[model samples]
Target: MAQKLQTGTSKTTRYAIWAILILTVLSTVALYASMFLSQDNNYKEAKVQQDNYKKYQEATEEYNKKADKQAKELSAKYYNSFKEFRKTPSAFKASDVKELEKKDLKVGDGEEITDKTTEFYAYYIGWKPDGSVFDGSFNKDELKLPLAVKKNNRGWGVIDGWSEGIQGMKVGGVRELTIPADKAYGSNGSPNQQDSAKSIAPDTPLKFIIMLIPKFEEIPQPNYKDYGF
Candidate 1:
């Protein structure tokens, strides 16, 4: 069994919900793996990685808590800025996911988001052509879109397809990316795949609605300066 944190209506935020969703899938494996390691008295490097993971999550929760009020405000600002571009997330007919494609619904005047850019913040909704919303950051005020791919391995800001697709988006832009499975979860679905009322199967092409947000809290990534990975 996994450990549970004390959460109440008063303390809950969208960010917290995001954390729970992430931890639910990934942390379980880490927790159980750490338990097995202790019993076996195994390799110390795994222990180090385990400790790093715990510390990273703790630091993140702290940041998310502090950024709660600010994040909502940012979401609102982005909403207003992109309201015209916003649309309900919907999917398309079966298409090859191997071919990466992108089209802009709304364009922004801000700086381009590139692999060299360190900070990334965005709001997104992901669904299939059938109109099933698999995952999204905001319940309202977002758009017709695709992935908010981050520049590099930097904590995998988005999927491989997203990484390439979201390259030139301005801070205020909205884009729709159609990703083939190869750039997404591929044949092996993600271990941390969001739990939805609808199932996301392996090898399924995905349609995503993404809005590159400015002024939201900075996404957490390891300091490359300190730890070169």
Candidate 2:
């Protein structure tokens, strides 16, 4: 009877091992099936995102090309009109410029700038008393697009001399402004992006040749979602 019990125990252990191995095989098969079924959806999502990004890139490129062309054409037209006044003054003294001075180069017959709150577009060249050009709206030989001067509490979002000097000036006009140090950059001076070597000095009087022009065609901002940005 003891011999028979030992044989039965061995058979039961073998059956248990077989059951574990079958369960493991089924689990592995189920895992692989699940992965296989979801692969199509994952691939579709990746393709959709890729297509949207491509569309965004194309649209942005087209928009930039058109805007650049329009700006260059506008710059070329007005640059020819204002190019003659791009000359340094013969004699200039910072101390002599105690008050804001204005010398009209070409007076315009267009709309008159009545108040400090008037918004306009302008092309300008600013220099020091020593005739060093610190900044301007020019790109080497060509003029860049006119910068939009928005209205502020002071005047056209500019310094005291510019606000006072440009008042009563009409569109399509060009004027030369000689600003005193107090009305210009004042004591702290200003930075020069064009010539990083020559920054505006403290108590430095400045001069500017300004040309006012009419507003250009507005370019709407591209939607970020449309560009996938």
Candidate 3:
């Protein structure tokens, strides 16, 4: 009877050890499966985000390219119409600009610039008496985008001649201005010292052909948040 009881106790001990080993193996397998699932989910999410960003970048590039092309085409259209006025005024002399003088190149039926504070956009070419172009809105033979002159409550944000000369001119009008030294840069070459390209000699007269155009609408840049950044 004593031998039988000892054998039964040994069998129970063996069964408990096997149960513990089996439970440990199952736990290890479960842990590995959970880790692999988490890693796979993270990788998929990263891939999705990368693909979205690439699509957004491509869309933004295409949008900007179209906008740029449209802008260039518009500029060229207006530029070609007024490029003929780029020639020097007939018998133009710096001495002839004793006072602010103006000659209308083309009259427009659009809204008149009745007030000095009325802001506008224009394409212009300024030249010295020698017919050398000092500054202009042209790039080689092509015209660049129109420049905006912001409104100032005080008056026009330009030379005294422009403020007075632009009066009564309508939108889409072209005007040639012969500005005297007093109404132009005066004794100073330019108000901005860093602007060496536009600088002129003291007491020098200048001429310009101004083409007023409609306001330009700007294209907005793409937002990162819109692309699920």
Candidate 4:
């Protein structure tokens, strides 16, 4: 009877071991399936995000093209209008302008200009080669302001054409300057003006009537070491 009981006990122990082995195998398989599903979901999400980004890039490019096109059209319209205006005899005729003449200018010939300076001045009317008024200083009465030349400012603030054109002009001298766009505002006109007035897109000509005023000296340069600045 004792031997029979021992055999039964061994059989029960073997059955329990088999059951534990089966459970472990099932758990491992379940864990593997979960991991695979998680990775697949992440891959799908990444693909979708990439597709969205591609679409966004394409849209941005299209928008820029459209904007550029519109800007060109607007510029063309303005350029044509300006041309038409020039054709009119009245447009070329201004009562304020006494005469049109050309004068050669030299460097360092004008008044000695320091870093920061101001001058009271008047001018007739200035035009680009296209006969557009680039500087309407003559249209106004008096201009009194400091001309800045430092970084982020209109340093050495002189229009290229005006500076070069009025070299030998005596103080209180008057003259008309017909400047090419290259000498005036170049491809991009002065900032803060209308787009139509810019030199870039339309690249219109420039003209000017300049009057010289008394030149003033600029403030002396500060010694950085003295202020420990």
| Alpha-carbon TM-score of each model against the true structure | 0.57, 0.66, 0.61, 0.34
**How well is each residue in 116-150 modelled by candidate 4, as lDDT tens digits?**
33443332444544355543422122322323232
**Residue 83 error, candidate 3, Å:** 1.4
Model 2 lDDT, full chain set: 0.81
* Alpha-carbon RMSD of each model: 24.8, 5.4, 8.9, 16.2
Model 2 TM: 0.66
Q: Tell me the spans in candidate 3 whose CA falls farther than 4 Å from its real position.
A: 1-70, 89-91, 191-197, 219-229
Candidate 4 or 3, higher TM-score: 3
Steric clash count of candidate 4: 22
Candidate 1 or 2, higher lDDT?
2
Rank the models by lDDT, top first: 2, 3, 1, 4
lDDT of 3 by residue, 1-229 (tens): 5653443457778899999999999999999999999999999999999999998889899878977786688777797777788674444578877888889999977778766445787888888777777788777777776767776666667888887788888889999999998998889766436865566888888888888887667566688888888
Backbone collision tally, model 2: 0
lDDT of 3: 0.80
lDDT values for all models: 0.68, 0.81, 0.80, 0.49
Estimate, for each residue in 1-229, the C-alpha lDDT of model 2 and write its tens digit.
Answer: 5664444457778899999999999999989988987997889878888888888777778878887787688877887887777775444777788888899988998888876445788899888887777778888778776777788664466788888898888899999999999998899988757877569888989899999998777666568676444
Q: What is the lDDT of residue 143 in candidate 3?
A: 79
lDDT of 1 by residue, 12-103 (tens): 58779889999897989899998997866766766766777777677667766756655566655566655543456655775645588898
